[model samples]
Target: MNWVLLIIAGIFEVAFAACLGKAKETTGNEMISWYVGFLICLAISMYLLVKVTQELPIGTAYAVWTGIGAVGTVLVGIFVFKEPASFWRLFFLLTLITSIIGLKFVSN
Candidate 1:
């Protein structure tokens, strides 16, 4: 259950990061709305992370959560945001994902 919350938190972290980028690209009212969404998503992400850390070790939880967020944010940047997708970026994203899975396997 804690892991589930952590994953959800990571997803929300991705959402907030994307919203932040979108907000930066917009102007005035649109930017304001996007910024608001980013804040809300960020709050939820942090809340869930707090929940996960209640039972999980802070070091492991934080590392896995951030790993998921980084990979997810990069994927969204590539797909929805249409940012550049260089070979090394994809390679490192896969490597991060592999490490995340490894963490899950080794963790109790």
Candidate 2:
């Protein structure tokens, strides 16, 4: 359950980051709304991440949270945001996931 929350925190972190990017790209009031949403989500994600860290090892929690966020952000950027889709990109993302799984055992 704690791991679940950590993963959620990671995902939200990715979302907020993407929103920040989009907000910067937009114009006027809509841009302000996006930045606001991004900031709020960022704060919540950090709070949840801190909660998970209290129970888990610092190294494990940080690695997993950041790893998930990186991979998830790339995925969302490619699929939902239509940034790009390529074999090389997918290959790297897979490598990241593999590394995270490896760290789970290695850190423990």
Candidate 3:
């Protein structure tokens, strides 16, 4: 249950981050929607993060949450924004994913 919450929070983190990126690209009325989306996702993500942290270790929970967010945001940046997709970047991304999984396995 908590794990599910954490995962959901992480997904929200991704959404908020993507919204931020899109907001930066927009202007006036176009930006408003992205900003609103960013705020909504940010709030939900934080709420879920706080809820999960009540039971999970803070360091572990934070790392995993940010890990998921980082991976998701990078993928979005790559696919949507067409950011750099060098071999090294992909390698490190995979490593981050592995570390996140390891943290989950080691936790209660």
Q: Candidate 3: give the clashing pairs.
A: none
Query: Residue-wise lDDT of candidate 3 within 1-108, one digit each (tens)?
Result: 989999999999999999999999999998999999999999999999999999999999999999999999999999999999999999999999999999999998
Return the TM-score for candidate 2, rounded to 2 decimals: 0.89
Worst 10 residues of 2 by lDDT: 99-108
Candidate 1 residue pairs in backbone clash: none
Clash pairs, model 2 backbone: none
- Give the distance in Å from residue 23's predicted Cα in candidate 2 to where it truly belongs: 0.4
For model 3, the superposed segments whose C-alpha errors exceed 4 Å read none
2 versus 3: better TM-score goes to: 3
- Per-residue error for 25 in candidate 3, Å, reads 1.1
Model 1 alpha-carbon drift over 4 Å, by segment: none
On TM-score, the candidate that comes out on top is: 3
- lDDT (C-alpha) at residue 96 in model 2: 93
- Write the number of the candidate with greater TM-score, choosing between 1 and 2: 1
Ranking by TM-score: 3, 1, 2
Give the Cα lDDT of each candidate.
0.95, 0.88, 0.98
